[model samples]
Target: MTKAANFIWYELMTSDPAGAAAFYGAVVGWTIAGGADPQAGGVDYRMIGRRDGGNAGGVLALNADMLAGGARPCWMGYLHVADVDAAIAAIEADGGVVHMPATDLSVGRIAMLSDPQGATFYIMDPIPPAGAEDMESDVFSVTEAQHVRWNELATSDPDAAIAFYRRHFGWGQDGAMEMGELGSYRFVQRGDVMLGAVMPLMPGMPAPAWSYYIGVDDIDRAAAAVTANGGTITNEPMEIPGGEFAMNAVDPQGAAVGFVGPRGG
Candidate 1:
């Protein structure tokens, strides 16, 4: 049996690449490399390096042409699939839209897509480097700092979104938390690893989208770094069921993100 698809990579599309690099570097303790000079004028793709020497993701500079074409600052994840074309077909048949058709790059074959409710993400069939065929991606982790710890989707339709993801990615609704009038926060999992949760859009959420939570060692210090670096804390840190605190914030360039860590006294 083939292994199920999982989110293997993440990228941030931002208008201010230099500023964003600085912001995330301070907040999440990431090292930004490449494309330091925005005025140099090329495809500005900066690699996000974790302290442990692993790459967490990348930051893409959105050009004027892209901005005019309706591109905005946002964080998108790449889901690794067995076949890119087959995944696109399955998505379209289930009411998802193909924003960018499958294109081959040095990294792999990838396509950008939006779900039935308009949450955008990418599907990739990666071509690993020579002698790295057996290597697994560690960009996402549940307990490690400086990695994506959770993937939450706030959509307009919870039931349909859950069903669609379940059909395509083999995600199971293992449990949920009742949120009074807001509805249930449904947790999604693949085998024993809890990926994240899906729920209806809250009152303050701008639209239907996926918000990724980056893990930090200290929640309170991370929140302070966000504001000090010109980012805005949208949701203050609050203790979750597991005793850790989760908070939401928008980057200096306006991309919404979240952080999960311990609230050190």
Candidate 2:
């Protein structure tokens, strides 16, 4: 990971990779290309808005024949770390488990981990794309990491979650916000910018699931695009209490994602 501690790849493991890529393209106006574009590669691995030959992300084909090891369809976030092995060691030492040991990729090494609370994510140490400069970025690029604004972990215990992150990454909690119905929402900041949240899961929800939010230019248009693209619209377009208009949607692969307009400061 030659870049800062920022998110790199935003992968979606789904039943049909091709269809998923098409769905995202229609909904987000992104030109799904690279291996994700079946015309470009034979494999099901596909990408959206591919340019500069960076390893941003793609939808992995998980059809019945392809699906194995009981991996459910979900949106996964991959952060660029300095060292894959070191990150694995830190994750396990912080009460996490190595869900997937370090695996070698053409670009770099990757490994998946789940915190003690069962929230799963991955870390990657990219090889800088051979002759390329770097794949990571300093500021969060909304267009690059599509459907990924912040990486939030809904832990069973917020206190323990904060402690674990602090011990592992030196990040601290930025305090909390109380939604009318969502109740208290704790904000976590890597340093100054609010990276994401650590909220309690809803009733009967899975324990400690990690989800990423995609920032959009217009919430209404984004939600409309979801339906137009053959994707399922989970939440109708609506304005939150603070004038934040958003809509929830799931790609063709059944990975839930949300699109929000400009967020008020």
Candidate 3:
């Protein structure tokens, strides 16, 4: 089967890796392991493991040099592509900026890029482990708890963003919801799966960015946990179309994140 351009991994670049790990562990119920080890390129990278024994994503500790270079704490999603070099070239031709040139790693060839509207994400061509060639990534799921359920893009130009993503990644606009002055909330889908939505940047959103919403068992409990752990709930938990509640939050390290689940009584 041909590879589809879908988000296969999520990552958090934060100043305090240990604190961010603890905060997410309490709020998202993820067990983080692996720290800065000289054996692993001396990078302070930790793995985010879900309860189901699958990896949700990873956390990379931002160093002083990264901060000096204006790298802020943020959550980034990696979209798997079949050809990273071709994707990078196409993206650049379509007004997208390539922040990091395509480079080969032990696991894959990857590159960092931003949409025309400045929403940043990564494109990776992953290499499966030996004998696991047929294994699919479960880091993104629409209903499973602890996995990313949604990948939302709030952009300065939704129409152009949609067009660019569709042209390059084969995403489709399944439908849209009218949001009055805030504009339309356009749902994006990859084949049959409803990935997430795209909407205009709301007031107080500093810039165009993507927000990955992780699935939780209880929305209310997660919202409370956000505050109890020094994180700020930007949007209160509210019912979405599918009867589940969702909320936007800012982690203590200043990265924006989201959660979606049932609001248990």
Clashing pairs in 2: 1-125, 36-46, 149-213
Find the 10 residues in a row with the least total lDDT in model 3: 33-42
* Per-residue accuracy of model 1 over 19-81 as CA lDDT, tens digit each: 987998899899887464353245778888999999998888898999999999999999988
Q: Indicate the TM-score of model 3.
A: 0.96
Candidate numbers sorted by lDDT from highest down: 1, 3, 2
Model 1 lDDT at residue 25: 88
Tens digits of per-residue lDDT, candidate 3, 204-231, equal 8889999999888899899888999999
Candidate 2: tens digits of C-alpha lDDT, residues 42-141: 5567665533444346667775664667887888887777788988887887689998899987667899898788888888887775666754443245
Output the better candidate (1/2) by TM-score.
1
Top-down TM-score ranking: 3, 1, 2
TM-score of each: 0.95, 0.82, 0.96
lDDT score, candidate 3: 0.90
Count clashing residue pairs in model 1. 0
- Which pairs in model 3 have colliding backbones? none
* After superposition, candidate 1 runs with Cα above 4 Å error: 1-3, 36-42
Root-mean-square deviation per candidate: 2.4, 4.0, 1.7
